[model samples]
Target: MKAVLFGIFLLAAGNASASCDLVSAPCSTDSSGNTYIREQNLGGGYNTYRNGDLYSQTHQQLNGTYRETYSSGGYRTYYSDPNRGATYQGDPKGMAGR
Candidate 1:
């Protein structure tokens, strides 16, 4: 498991820091924290862990490639090369039934 600070820095909530793993990866994940986006802004991405569950998604251009992660777990990743492009369309995954 890797520790990654994702999304806009909402300040440190004491000890509830951000991390990256199988449940919370960097991609098109969503959150219950009002605003949601997976393009990994504010660095790369952020994952919220609680009750043995995870929620997050983020993407950013790294090394000339677009790195993306969906709520489809954290271990996997989809990267768009320098000239390639990709898209993900659907409701938020894992956290909500929608």
Candidate 2:
């Protein structure tokens, strides 16, 4: 009886830990043959998603700008200017005049 209880506890704990891990895959299938997915960080950060042919993502930065590129085609970019406490967004461009 004690061994069974211990096994059950371990299984529950494992499940809880697994929930905090990052997941990357199709979450569901719709009637029109569309799929949805969510990508997240296990720790503490941003989450992103890709649905059908469209892709979108976001990130949490500690000090500077955060940038990411998608496999579909285009890219998403963001930045926080520490001196002015402002944020900027646009396509992936070179930082020369800033």
Candidate 3:
């Protein structure tokens, strides 16, 4: 019974390390001097954030494709590899029409 309890404790501790919480927001000012808040995911591949007027998103797939979305209804997708430069897809104008 004691060994079983110890095993359970170790399993719980290891699972906790897989999850994370944001310590603070990432903020910045644009060229027009508009201040905004930004948040990033500590995990490299995928992250999501909510700012004052925009919702930002990012994802990096295992196949080396990166995607980002903006609240303005626009999204940019890119593919990165050693043999080629970053290729962009989707509507550069905005996703409002879609």
Highest lDDT model number:
3
For model 3, name the residue pairs that clash.
Answer: 26-38
| lDDT (tens digit, per residue) of candidate 3 on 23-74 | 2443433344443444445775433332234455666767777666666666
Model 1 poorest 10 in a row by lDDT: 14-23
The alpha-carbon lDDT assigned to residue 5 of candidate 2 equals 100
Q: Which regions of candidate 3 are displaced past 4 Å? A: 1-24, 42-51, 79-98
Which candidate tops TM-score? 3
Give the per-residue lDDT digits (tens) of candidate 2, residues 1-98: 99999999998876543332333442433345434344456753333343434344445566556644445555545564311222212211212233
User: For all the candidates, what are their Cα RMSDs to the real structure?
Assistant: 12.8, 11.7, 13.2
Count of backbone collisions in candidate 3: 1
Any idea what lDDT model 1 has? 0.37
Task: Pick the winner on lDDT between candidates 1 and 2.
Answer: 2
lDDT of each: 0.37, 0.43, 0.46
lDDT of 1 at 90: 40
